[model samples]
Target: MSLSPMTSVVVAASLAIASGAADAADYRNNPFTLTYDGAITQNLPGRVNIHPVTYKLNGLDISANVYTPPNYDPKKTYAAIVIAHPNGGVKEQTAGLYAQRLAEQGYITLAADAAYQGASGGLPRYVDKPSNRVEDIHGMADYISSYAGVDKARLGLLGICGGGGYSLKAAQTDKRFKAVATLSMFNSGRVRRNGFMDSQLSSVQARLQQASEARAQEAAGGKVLYANDVVLTDEQIAKLPFEMYRQGFEYYGKTHMHPNASAKYTLSSLLDLMSFDATNQIELINQPLLMIAGSKADSLYMSEDAFSKATGTKDKELFKIDGATHIETYWLPKYVNTAVAKLTQFYARTL
Candidate 1:
């Protein structure tokens, strides 16, 4: 039964529409679905278990996954770690993977969705306000301290990508986090203001111009549009200046794509990011700090720059994973293992 090309196109379009509707319904009801590729179940020993938990923080119901260590006793308090996800990422992404792995290593780990994103609550979804995001970290620490089986005094923090920057900001004021670590930490403010590697310094005025237009549109009752770096086709992806952008899509857009994950962010809120600087208060942090970044990453300079600006002495360490790119450290075994090992040692020593 050979159909005409137009007929084939119509059939394909119909199927896509139906599939999209079904997905939308599922998302509206459940918000998230865990795709068990047996990565965790098969690899983790039978003793460890990951539990999905929800708690309220700052008038919002926050969703997170908590991994309990094997042979856990309620009477015995255990050290805990709070894992924050990358920008445009939910808890179930790399954060969840790291949390599960750390739980297998005998530490209780909690991976949380940032406010206004993923399963967490906020109005005008996907707003990436720096202060609110930093508060989310502190909120997670509060949740950890309230747990009966968790020791509040031995709390540690781990953040990936933008979350890494937020973790550093949180640790500045929240001394409850005895140790802090970041994986491929991104200084969102620096990149927003000066661009990655400072290559877009001259384009700052242009970006501000675009943002002003976006604001004008919003004022005129227009829905805000988002500009995402995700490239769908080879031609579109070829336009990326570096290989890391293409690699990031592989990790976040394809292999581990979540229905709740969004590629775009509100254009108007971008101005907030440009003005937000997390590194300004690094001098206030007195806890042990670990900053992990890939030497080959285009974003590596941000982490290095932050580490240099941090006034914390004696306990701060910067580890560069040789030959790895920024996005490669997200889920790659070699990079993930290196990060887990470094983080485990850092927390073990400090907490």
Candidate 2:
């Protein structure tokens, strides 16, 4: 007997889930499930603590981790930062690392899995629309602002990779984010519309047609289609042309792999992503801005472009980490330290 295509997809999805559960079991003893270096293994009294939390966002449960500074006192006020993870990334990866580091700097930091992408709640998982991503940031701000000891007026936002793009868009009108920052910003809309480095410029229309069809199929209750669903071999990953993507595989798929982290998204998401622009109406953001990128990153253009267009803020600055590639800033001690230091200063001054 032969399996139908839908059966094959369902079986594959089941296997992926089982594999993820097995991988996650390795960290079952560790409550936080954090995979970053120097992560807190236990929440000790009188020290920075990781608090697992869940809140409602658009009728879905949003899972997040709140890192509170050492000796945190709810009676006293403190600034807060909402850290948004990269596309396909969960709160347990680099986002958690940054949130922990910022917590160590005496600020409360919250990192949540994007709804539908990580451990958060949503139907038809891996839907990656820009509007949804932007709302994730706003929802974070809303939740963290009410957190004990957080000063609602001093809230800040930090977005990494694709999260950076959504953060920019979120801060454009949210206004509650007094300061906005991005690390190795990736404009999902731009890449989705024109392809990486505009390599697929000729196929924009073709891709749109496919996305339209995918949406139609979903509306008709057809089996959902996914993009970037297959895992790649190491050889294939190494052959990837862009350094950002090449090292991204090592970071996301190997060394820093997490059960919730993935690369797949609903194919119909392109219908929304293709027309979305992170920098559109960017001038509406009057808050302080800081954009950081690796000097050698191929994705540096995205940060630079957004920085230049952020004309609404006179206090904006673009900082580059010398010699660091896009993914290197995520985990490399030296680069991460430098980026965190600059971020600490920027938040101290602006938040």
Candidate 3:
């Protein structure tokens, strides 16, 4: 395995133990147990709390959480946004946080667990194909556009981290979304093929061979191989490189982990991920666009590249959160608040 990915395994294992090992199911009921300061723990006095829901997507059952606005009246129309979770995330993590916050702003929001991952129903679980992930975003929009009290014409979309990349790809063809926004977008294709910052360029052919072999094994009725599932010590995790990987382990693998989210994907997924590029046709997004990233985030390049290539949208802007890294923007209040404020304004104006 590449050092960039192997080191991340060390970080996840170490932090999972450090965050107080327990039954993963026990963490779901109270998602805010390790949430950032001021995180809403229950339904706001007048707002609707998360409504655990299930919908059909491509013949599979997809689980999701819908947060309705305060004093929500089904008879009155309201804007809606479909929020997609990060690659290793679920509806109960950062995606849920942003969904709830957007609901508070009077927009009905839906965050769903992608098909084949999290609580969704799919065979050979944890497949991470770009086509499937992008379809998941389109499915979210389809489900939310017809939801009670939603104004289909004013629908919007928000994607974080890996989801941000998928969201861009989805919005490229799904023009139903009036506005599109992404936070700390991480191009899964670029990194999966070239390695983080292209560090694994030399090993591309070798890794592709590995992935092909894995796919063949699965096709032969063999057990599925997984990636990003490793065990390590706290001391080891602390010494790993990359703040995003380090702190990300703490967020998803540790404090905020959910039972349905294991942070691992089928090793064979590398085949599709390596071949897909979210920015390949980004100019198709003619709707208003807002891409936000932390100034210090190493993943900022993906967002910048996507923003520069988005020639179809004249009303596009790139905002940066000063001094914040990618993972820090996931839960840290200072940066989360800034992102939410900008998103609120952007959606209000465009959607």
Which prediction has the highest TM-score against the true structure? 2
Task: Give a tens-digit lDDT track for model 1, residues 1-351.
Answer: 232211111111000011112221132333335422323442244576777788988888898888888887768899999998887788877788788778877788899888888888887677777888899999889887877589998998998888999898999989899989999898777766665566566667777667678778988998875545223464544455566666655555455667677655666666788788779878888888899999898788878888998887568999998888988787777887888887778887888
TM-scores for the candidates: 0.86, 0.92, 0.92
Better of 1 and 2 by lDDT: 2
Distance from true location, Cα of 53 in model 3, Å:
0.8
- The residue-by-residue lDDT of candidate 2 on 114-221, one tens digit each, is 999789999899998999999999999999999999999999999998999999999999999999999989888988787667666677787788789999999999
* Candidate 3 segments exceeding 4 Å error: 1-45
lDDT tens digits, residue span 152-186, model 3: 99999999988999999999999998999999998
Candidate 2: deviation at residue 254, Å?
Answer: 0.9
How does model 2 score by TM-score?
0.92
lDDT of each: 0.73, 0.84, 0.81
Q: What are the per-model numbers of colliding residue pairs?
A: 0, 0, 0
Q: State the RMSD for candidate 3.
A: 3.2
Which structure among the candidates has the greatest lDDT?
2
Model 1, TM vs. native: 0.86
Error of 3 at 74 (Å): 0.5
